[model samples]
Target: MNNDESQPENNKPKYKGKYRIDSTRLPAWSYASNAGYFITICTHGKKCFFGEVVQGEMQRSPIGVIAQKLWYEIPNNFSNCQLDSFCVMPNHIHGILVINQIREGDAMNIRIQEEDAMNRVSTSQRGDGQRGGVTGLFNPMLSKNSLSKIVRWYKGRCSFEINQIYEGFGWQQRFHDNIIRDEFALDQIRQYIINNPINWESDREHPPHPPL
Candidate 1:
């Protein structure tokens, strides 16, 4: 199996072309930098494996429970990362992630500021957004903390666990993301996620229902 936790040679995903979509990532931006990002990850073929929205509420399936749980666990795995607004819909998930690592350009100034911030804060007060010593910019494997790596770990882990009972569970080839530039944008995205379940019927990502 590959690092992405792909199935053994004997079993392969039913779908191909997961890598067909062109990347929407910014060329000059360093994904591991200090910033907030909005993320959307969809199940393969838009399957509603996560369960449905009922009376404007989300009812998670076994798989859905796993998805939501692991998302919360992200902060534990990546010290510099912290989750914000999050929701798991019938076929997809939406969340905001804040990376507190130093930005690439002007690394010196950023590192100094990061160090100052860390100094002013104590370990217990960091809450869910735990802050470690000023690091990440000097990480030997920079990509280790990059956004793509984080998402890959998340998707791969989810598939591995989900495939245990339901073999061949798959995710869309790539996820969609938007770098949140300001608090206004962040607030808007947060509300969108909060409202996802209530607005499921009209959501573009909503899967088609079978005829009654």
Candidate 2:
């Protein structure tokens, strides 16, 4: 019997070096694929800038209202995206964002933002003012319907609006996402979103100010 071959594969040493932060995303995964994604975005340093929890319920401050306003606007900005369950917490948020199928000729117009803010245009009105063929764009990075791109737009818009009133409002540099693999898992995540406010005190994403 060969001792080397007999050793379990788990005992092998692939690398004897310090590990660095690895991506949370699955390797070779195409986010553009039609699916449901559970996402969480935290405020900078998990600060309770949005609002507070009173009686086990989340109450969005004036600023928190802005955070939620932009969240619900995601579908308006990206034609093929739809929001499932979502809730705005004091310092963090939880939601299930679904990328849905787009039928043909449904697109009436498309809009994109460039490096120059002054050059930005908001309206993408088609003759019928409808959105169509979102997946046909092919290049997810550049497509209006891409998940990452949609998130970026939402963050940027919310920051822009909030900053106008409260300067330096920001979100964490990186957000977290979990890919939903089955209908059962999808329903579970959606329920979590709905119950986030009720579970605020016990939530890991909850802030430290209230000292829960």
Candidate 3:
């Protein structure tokens, strides 16, 4: 009668095979494109015990902490991308990510080359010629860089760190993603990601009730 027990005599697949794509196996174009996407990633085998709902609040599992930190830093790491909204629950994460194209010969490129030189100079002495200014590190326009690569890179690093913290901790082999084609859809997805934590108790993915 345990909640984690598999359904008796059922052959239903555990995940959406049609939508699941291994982030590690995706082609270059997938990461190079400037298109924005909303992605959902779940724990391996949908394990719910990674964390628990206490007093109507979802507490982060050790793995969840890694996920949250990595998700927040996505924007800083990928100058052309934005982490709009995200929620980390006990066994999964839902996030809205915007991928903007990075234009050639822009500030980002200029800053990249100047980083070493700037390091040698004091902050006050660097003045206007400093290589690693705010404008150099980030692009104001969101459409100039690749978002997919940012997510993949973040996930890869998080997995490595999580493995070090808790032996055998890792994400599933693949993740679920939906490309937002219009503003309306994007807004809806943003709201969904923001509200995910509040709706966790009623989620279909929550462990099923025991049979009589």
Enumerate clash totals for all models, in the order shown.
Answer: 0, 4, 9
TM-score of each: 0.71, 0.69, 0.60
lDDT of 2 by residue, 1-212 (tens): 11100111222211112111122454223455577877777788888878887886877888899989999999887878888888888887777888875755333223212222112222222223322222122223544466677777877898899999888778887666667789987776666666666777666666557621
- Candidate 2 has an lDDT of 0.63
Model 3 misplaced stretches (Cα beyond 4 Å) = 1-31, 105-148, 208-212
- Residues 131-159, candidate 1: write the lDDT tens digits: 33222232212445767678887898899
Better of 1 and 3 by lDDT: 1
Instruction: State the TM-score for model 3.
Output: 0.60
Winner on lDDT between 1 and 2 is: 1
Best by TM-score: 1
Report the C-alpha displacement of residue 187, candidate 3, in angstroms. 2.0
TM-score of 2: 0.69
Clashing pairs in 1: none
